[model samples]
Target: MPITEILSYGFMQRALIAGTLVAVLCAILGVFLVLRRLSLIGDGLAHVTFGSVAVLLLTRVGAQSVSLAAIPLVMLASLGILRLTDKARIYGDTAIGIVSSLGIASGVVLASVAGGFNVDLFSYLFGSILAISPMETWIAAALFLIVLVAIALYYHDLFAIIFDEELARSSGIRVAAINRLLVLLTALTVVLAMKVMGIMLISALLIFPAVTALQVARGFRSTIVIAAVCAVVSVVGGIFVSFVANLPTGGVIVLVNAVLFVAAYAFRRCKE
Candidate 1:
């Protein structure tokens, strides 16, 4: 089908717009996360989202409200990870692992108690981007703008912290506050991204484009731009290709990003 015909459908339009916005958001935040060695944070937050969704379902929250309700829960979990790292003196990965395990376990127990997953829950688990509502598209746009503005405001501090936190702190950067902001933003991105990439594949969306850009990017700003471009391409291409091939949009998007990563790696090797 032609591009115009595919985009003529309302669902397709929503998916394209929402998916692109979410992809760019993930890619931008992902650059910081990957460099900070917090890439797994996305996966951890995603598991929390799964558990939160289960709780919401059991509580009989309306399907339309589940995504909105999940934001605060996941944000709290993100802060919990930070607390574990700070007060408990746990390593970053170890802290993430602890929270991630708990989140998934809670979801499993709750799911079993609820007599198993429902159709709505399954959609969240595996994603249903093609069925994205207009409200969600608006949500995506809002999230994108918020993240963009935050990054602009904290660009220098984020840059400093990414390269050397201790040095950033010495420079009066308030590394702790920046760290919290990063994770909180990441939490929000993870929650919104559940509908685009699903809980299982959300990490790939967060990690792939950033890593791919790193393979070839010349500077930090360039990396962010390149990562965003790669993510946007993956989302747009994934939506169209999945529709044509009758495959899952979330999985296809991840696969597209993986392909981009491989291609980037190959290009880097050839250049070397």
Candidate 2:
């Protein structure tokens, strides 16, 4: 099928628009998380989204509202991960692991109690971007703008904290606030991205683009730009390929990102 024919379908149009927006969001936030070694947080929070979706499913919430409602619940879980690290004296990965385990466990038990997974739950598990509603697309666009603006406002503080929290704090950067903000933003992005990449593969969207950019980018700003471009390309390319091949869009998108990473790594080595 020609690209123009594919773009003629409304569902395809929605998928492209929303997927691109969420991909860019993940790429930008992934840079900060990757630099700080908090990339796992995306995976961790993705599990939390699963649990949150399970709860919403159990309540029989409308499909459209589930994403919005999951936002706060997952945000709270993200903060809990932060608290575990700060007050419980746990390592960051351990804290993420604890929260991740709890989230998946809750979802599993809930699934069992609810008489196993339903189609709705499965859609979220693996993603259904081609079925994204009009409202969800607007949500993606709105949150994309909000997060982009927030990052722009806090870029310097985030940059400082990513390199050295102690120094950023000593420099009067309000390390705790910035840390919370970062996690909160990440949580929001993860929830929004669940539709684009699903619970199982969402972190790839966050990690791959940013890391791939690091292999070739010469500066921080350039890294962000490159990552965003990579993510957008993956989403667009993945959607078209998946459409033509009748494959899962989310999986194809991740594979596209993986291919980019390998190519970037090879290029970096060749340069060296």
- The sequence of per-residue lDDT tens digits that candidate 1 reaches over residues 173-201 is 99999999999999989988999888999
| lDDT tens digits by residue: candidate 2, 1-272 | 78888899999999999998998989999999999999999999999999999999998989999999999999999999999999999999999999999999999999999999999999999999999999999999988898889999999999999989899989999999999999999999999999888899999999999999999999999999999999999999998999899999999999999999999999999999
**How much RMSD separates candidate 2 from the native structure?**
0.7
Model 2: residues with Cα > 4 Å off, grouped in runs: none
C-alpha TM-scores of all predictions: 0.98, 0.99
Query: Highest lDDT: which candidate?
Result: 2
Model 1 misplaced regions, further than 4 Å: none
TM-score of 1: 0.98
**Per-candidate total of colliding backbone pairs:** 0, 0
